[model samples]
Target: MATTEEIEDLIARSALGDRAAFSRLYDRTSAKLFGIILRVLKDRASAEDALQDAFMKVWRHASRYSANGASPMTWMITIARNTAIDHLRRRKETVDADDAADRLVSSTPTPEQSAVAAGEARRITACLDELEQDRGAAVRGAYLEGRSYADLAESFGVPLNTMRTWLRRSLQRLQECMAR
Candidate 1:
């Protein structure tokens, strides 16, 4: 792990367009940053994508880090966190749009559609039941009750990021269970 001063120096050099400095910075920090993103994203592929995006932002915005008064690692973590959250928000929007389209096409479900929906609901419930109690509750609060992350975090008496991690992991578990 790079010391804060070393990271800061690398950020400074990176701001000056030193590709080697940026590469060193990445080598020093990518694992930590990727872990942070993975906690938010759950999916390794999406976390990898977010990590790449975060580094691109870091390269472009290194000049702003000093003025922001955060340590280099802190600044980089913020970038990674925000990038993962943005990815989640975009995914939610896309899901919402798809759901709306599905609704418009199926105001009244046929027998087959109803049966499929019932099976899906049961499968989701079974998956939720497989999770630890609090994780399952957090997943339900976030999805079924339409609770915001902040709201769920506060209710659960955990940090916002911890809440996100719980939900992400829970959802991943649910996905796996449903696939079976």
Candidate 2:
């Protein structure tokens, strides 16, 4: 692992249009960067997009980054984090900086945390598993995929009222199961 000083030196060199140094920096930090973006965006496609934007900023504004102010990883993460938050803000999505900060702290799920998330996913899957197949599918379409109720109704070829009922019941059931 590179010390903070070594990393800052590399970043400063990269800022001067050193492609090889930049590549080395990216290699050392992409996974951590991607993980940070993923937690904020919560969508793989959006997170990947944000990661690209963040790296571009790092490339362009590398000179602005200062060693005394923040570590290299912290500087890179600030770039990534700000880029992601900017997207959300421009999209008129939630714009809570504190929430984003909290997420940054909690985002990196460890192996144990991953197992817990998987277990929760499994339990939720099981709960959905217990629902009528169509209803379960409808719930997944709306919540997991971020589809609106109307969109889900149209996709399922069902009446809006029916879709509403399905969503309502599915949410109630999920809440009940999760509460246990």
Candidate 3:
């Protein structure tokens, strides 16, 4: 672990385009910076990305560090912290498709939901059974099968208005049965 003065010397050397000093500085400080970024981002992959971005900023702005009057490690840590926060903000703005896919809830009904649905189906079936046989069939055809009134009338050998009447009356009866 380098002392604060030693880290500052490395930053000054790096400012002068000394690759060895920059590499040494990276070695001394990357772990602490990475730790900070990981704490902020909470995801290892995103932390690594923030770490990279933080270092890129460090390399670019190393020349300006002398006038900042902060210790070199503090400077680097500030950069890493701000970069991690920005990374988190950007991540919040755009969701990854893979993440979205992973988060997708199953469309299949839960057991309780399925049970309630089955009970409703049974009730509707019972109500239909209470109707006259032809009327029950007509109700099923018009509602369940999605047949038009004219088509149901043709199939049942009734006038269009008569089929409409049967459906309206049958629904009223079903609604009453359901209420009970």
- What TM-score goes with each of the models? 0.56, 0.49, 0.51
As for model 3, its CA RMSD to the true structure in angstroms is 25.3
Question: What is the C-alpha lDDT profile of model 3 across 25-108, one tens digit per residue?
Answer: 899999999987877678899889889888877877788787564456767877887677667656666533232111223345
Number of the top candidate by TM-score?
1
TM-score of 2: 0.49
Tens digits of lDDT, candidate 2, 1-180:
667777787789888999999888888888888887766668789888878888887887777675224446776877777677666555555655332222333244466755555556558887887788988988876543445677779988998899998889987997678545
- lDDT against the true structure, each candidate: 0.76, 0.72, 0.75
Q: What value does the lDDT take at residue 144 in candidate 3?
A: 34
lDDT of 1 by residue, 1-180 (tens): 689899999999999999999999999999998988877778899889889988998888887776654446767877777777667766666532221111112134466765665566569887888899999988866543346788799999999999888888888888788767
Better of 2 and 3 by TM-score: 3
Please list the residue runs of candidate 3 whose C-alpha ends up more than 4 Å from where it truly belongs after superposition: 94-180
Off by over 4 Å in 1: 94-147, 150-180
